[model samples]
Target: MWFFIQAALYDNNITFSTLGPPKFIDRQEVPNVPLNAPKPVIGLDASTKVATDAFDDLEPEMIYLPLSAYSHYRLRGRSQNYPLLYEYFDINPYSGKLETSRRVSDLSMLEIVTGSMRPLHTGDFVGLSLKLVYFFFGILLSMMIFSGMMIWTKRTYKSTQTLLSRSTKAPSKTTKPEPSV
Candidate 1:
């Protein structure tokens, strides 16, 4: 549990850093940038336009995607109005579009699980490599935990046996043969 929590926090930090500071813009102020523009302004205000170019300036190895909203709704066994909702977003690398409209239950477990490791639509060597690293790391962690538990159980059993043997013998030797009948 501790390891899981730590891993989760670490991933969250990496994601936060990759996305950078949030730059919220009113929907009305958004610029009409062409989808194919080399550097499109994703957000804009009265004074200046914040171009998608800003993301390019980030560390070359960092994986970043623009802000997206995702919604997942499942009726489950409940009434129509009681559906569960989960939200998230992903980017379209080709068109540079932020696709946020999705229902959580509509996605398969694999899609939801792998979404963070790489881009959904595009496959690249770097993304594959990163995913492999994560897979191996999880396996390694599980092995380490199993080995540690085995060691602990072995030591505990040995100590318990030693203690029982000593206790059983100590009483026999310490009690003077009860007064002879």
Candidate 2:
């Protein structure tokens, strides 16, 4: 869950919510619509435009041609565009979208892992799996912290007991003979 949130924030170029509004890259621009226009209806194609108003609220990063299935590429910053950063798997055996990209062949394993210049999609099974993995690890980390505290407390109790015993014994041993006078 934390990974997903960080990815969301990083992709959107938003450091903090209070800093500013979120931004995204529109895959394509609506015809006759100005690029700088506010809240323009956006879509991949002309017919699909009428059906989906989902992208209407998002701030567009860039207007480009030949919009893909996953269009919204979140912005990294003012200087560079955020790379595509997701991988999808087909649940159905009969049909699946084949992974094909002009850029994918050029990407190294580290690049893919870091999402340096990769594109992310919403329906990515791998990305979703990672979220679940991180959640489990987070729980495990909390358990480890609790166990460590318990060990420290036990050690502290033992040390305190030893000190109390030594102090009491010293008081008894320091007593002087009353017949000295």
Candidate 3:
């Protein structure tokens, strides 16, 4: 059908969102600052050491996706092309520390660039499949009910006509010879 062809070939117009830091504008924006900025100060002092009681009032950032090699991001480090993504905490709350670190390290070591372009996942497939299955089943059920009702009404009308004919013909058979005399 024309509708099906259009639906199958139509652009889904999928929207993708990224949780990483914004792009850096310039290298010499700040005086005495390296081109690659340091990690966010998470209760750390000037010596790059964690400050006392820093975690007592930890305000975590909001993260939606699971931490993975695809989500690991980094900047160029001192004497290195890019700092390890594990230098920062995984923004995802559900991620285990070891798993998060491992994913970050794997991405950084292999120099893989990851972003929102990761292919649509299993959840998307499952959801679409369910929607289509339910839609077809609903259409089939509606058609079946409609055809069944039509057939039932037709059979009922034929039965009523047969009953009326039998009752009317029985009386004519009993009054046979009265007109002959």
Please rank every candidate by TM-score, starting with the best.
Answer: 2, 1, 3
Number of the top candidate by TM-score?
2
Q: In model 2, which runs have C-alpha deviations exceeding 4 angstroms? A: 1-43, 46-102, 108-129, 172-181
Lowest lDDT sum, 10 consecutive residues, model 3, at: 43-52
How far is 12's C-alpha from truth in model 2 (Å)? 22
In order, the Cα lDDT scores of the candidates are 0.42, 0.41, 0.36
Candidate 2: count the clashes: 10
| lDDT tens readout by residue for model 1, 1-181 | 5346547977787332223343433444344557776534332221011112222221122224434322111111111231222233333332334433234455666444544343322322334676677678779999999999999999999999999998988855466676876
Cα lDDT of model 2 by residue, 65-158, tens digit: 3233333322211111322432211111111111121232344565455453222323223346766776787789999999999999999999
Candidate 3: tens digits of C-alpha lDDT, residues 46-110 = 11112112222222222233233233222111112222121233321112211222232334322
How far residue 115's Cα lies from its native spot in candidate 1, in Å, is 14
Better of 1 and 2 by TM-score: 2
Give the C-alpha lDDT of model 1: 0.42
Best by lDDT: 1
